[model samples]
Target: MFTPQGPTLRELAAQALSSVEHGYDLLAPKFDHTPFRTPDSVLDAVGGALRPMGPFESGLDLCCGTGAGMDVLAMLCDESVTGVDISAGMLAVGRERLRADGPPSGIGERGPSVAWVRGDARALPFGPAFDLVVSFGAFGHFLPRELPGLFAQVHSVLRPGGRFVFPITAPPRPSSPWYWALLGFDAVMRVRNALWRPPFVMYYRAFRLGDVQRELAWAGFAVELRALPEFGYRRDGSPRCRMVVATRGGGATPV
Candidate 1:
């Protein structure tokens, strides 16, 4: 699951015992080495899917954990890119990485000017300022009940006609070993959360694609799902993964 540089079992146990912010802070330095970091392949696939919708002016990466989505935003947005997260330690690590190999500091030089802001996704610090917003691999941290507020926050931050995009893979078939693995994982998390204080909230099965699309619609966004060809199709011929592109609009669109 983790590289040698990633957190050890004891370290992971310690993190799980702490609050979500604190757990992430403790794991921030070694986050990219862990499986929890969004894979570069998914980011590349999403970048390809977004290329047609862009040449966007400004972009935001909500709940960016170590800033992987910023690279995608830089490729699509011409003006500026901002990554927001709740963990200051994670932001600090991201800042160090950006300073090491980030885009040009000057806006409109070569790539988009990038900035990292520490804040919560539920109550964003910005207004309708971004033309494109992307999030990767962070939804599992948010419970099902929190979907409406989270969707509303994303809707509020995006400029009129702007897009809110994210990649969501199909749930594993019940017959597959992966399905039982995830079920066991979620069950263990539930037990842990029940017994633990300052609960470390994370679940693999809570963010259902159907429920998410409906919540996005209720939040005043026109939603569309685009199949990503990179992962190919499942046995049923449906896309293995789809990019949900929600646009801020007055009327609803097909999901």
Candidate 2:
């Protein structure tokens, strides 16, 4: 929910008219205050899920707006946690936030290192450097067609047997009002994109889990869906949210 401190309607409209990168730049300052930011519950849940697999040497947070996922990396990784985003303004804010969080959990992980890099997700700058890669709340920015490239970028940057982790929620059922709300939102975005320039690409229904699973497999990842017990199950007995652990080099010969 948008609060009094959040971006105003006019500001949001202006952002919607701007390029995805520029819009995020414009919104960076107020992003954490908005509902758009990943909630603490989700963050803590993901952190708990990754805790057992921890002591990872290096971790990367892809599209790490305001560095929310950075907290997870800092907790689970033993050395070097990095954040990458296309928006410089967002990266700047993320760095500042990390600093304020204090020693180990914040920007102070520098002995082992905590850094921010400005880069596009499609063509990540590093090569096979991260032991674990995580992203949160940024997938709506990528269209369905871009998932293959995005997954490939993640795969390319992970060391052999490294994992790319992200959470996926169960889609709302058609009979639910939430589903209709999302459908309406996507419809509005399509019309907005058709009429607008600089296209702010965000669609709630675009990245279906089944399609994403297949795409991840095609990108050379052996994808596994681990139920996040923290979020509980839906009426149908499926997890409300699942942590996708996609491992690279699963089929490759050891060096």
Candidate 3:
């Protein structure tokens, strides 16, 4: 899944041995070349799904590694877009990508301004200053127990009725090969953490939709699910991908 520009096997081993923050810092330079980066297709799908609900003002991209989600924010938000990450290296690369790529398509000549901040997702450094927040492909770094705190942080950063949106894929069935693959991946990660110092937390199976929905509600969000038609549905007739729109209640804002 990794391209030639991606990290070497030895380099990846070194990163796997480091702490999560430091590991991402080391991998930041070649991250987009790796399969770890969120696919453009997913980004486009989310952006399309959110367009009708948006026209949002200020937006935040929580755990915004390499600022992939910021592109979507630029398309949806009118004023400004901020990307927060724990890794300085990742933020630096994100800034470079912004500079090189310029504004995303569909944004006007006076597109939303962009900024990068280095901060943990559990304790964001902003007030309730954002109208919307979006994240992509960064949840696995957080353990299952951290969901409440993480969702709370997102809630705290958003204005009342503002949305905290992210796309989640339906879990693979027990009969599917992907199910066993992810199960084995999580098992390996558990063993690695058991044996190593400064754990690099990345598990594929830990973030379940039921658990996440409950945590979002506890964190004070009225949650809704929107199917992304682009990815289609499973043979079981469930959506392959759905966007979770968690609105911090109290106001009547449509989104």
Candidate 4:
């Protein structure tokens, strides 16, 4: 669902027909107003979960649309934080927001600084330079086939023992309305891609937990899932949401 400030139906239709990058570029200005943006609650939960693991030196926000994940990085990392996204329009909005917020201060001589980089997630233009990396609500942009390469790229950019953290909500059960809604969305997306140019590779049901864990392991990450207690549990007693923390294999790096 979208707000009055969000993209109109016609604008959304135009975006859907465009390439993923162009679609996001068109949607960038109004992205934060849409339900598609990562919610503040999820971000806060992630920040709280990551605080104990950090005091990290440098951080990266992968696929950082409008830099929402940068807030989590700022809380955990002491030195600097970089938000990377493919859309120039998104980066522009992110840069302006960060500038307005100013650098975060406290706990050290240098406060956390924010930088925006425009680039593809599959081919990140960075070395093993980051002590922590995080992405929020951006996984659907990559198809299942792309997960391996995407995780590998994140691994490449992280220092050994650095983490790639993100929160994942448990899939809705078959009886749930959310389940049918997502199924319908994926079905429509499939049809749209079949009949249109520049396919948008976003599918709600495609990113299975088992497959994702296996791919992360293959990409040299030791994975763990921490339950986000703020969201409570499902009827079966499983966590409603969990934060996936994948640390690159090796000894822990100094903060």
TM-score of model 2 vs. true structure: 0.94
For model 3, what is the error of residue 15's alpha carbon versus the real structure, in angstroms, after optimal superposition? 0.9
Where does candidate 3 stray beyond 4 Å?
106-109, 251-255
lDDT of 3 by residue, 148-248 (tens): 88988888889988999999999999999999999998898899999999999999888899999999988889999999989999997899999999999
Quality of model 3 by C-alpha lDDT: 0.91
Cα TM-score per model: 0.95, 0.94, 0.96, 0.94
10 residues in a row with least lDDT, candidate 4: 102-111
Per candidate, the number of residue pairs that clash is 0, 0, 0, 0
lDDT of 2 by residue, 177-246 (tens): 9999999999998999999886889998998999999998888888899998888898879999999999
Top TM-score model: 3
Flag the better candidate by lDDT, 1 or 3.
Answer: 3
Model 2, residue pairs in steric clash: none
lDDT of 1: 0.89
- The regions of model 2 sitting more than 4 angstroms off are 104-111, 250-255
Tens digits of lDDT, candidate 1, 106-219: 344677778899999988999788999999999999999999989888888887899999999999999999999999999999999998898888999999999999999889
lDDT of each: 0.89, 0.88, 0.91, 0.88
- Candidate 4 runs further than 4 Å off: 101-109, 251-255
- Tens digits of per-residue lDDT for model 4 on 107-150? 23567776889999998999899999999888888989999899
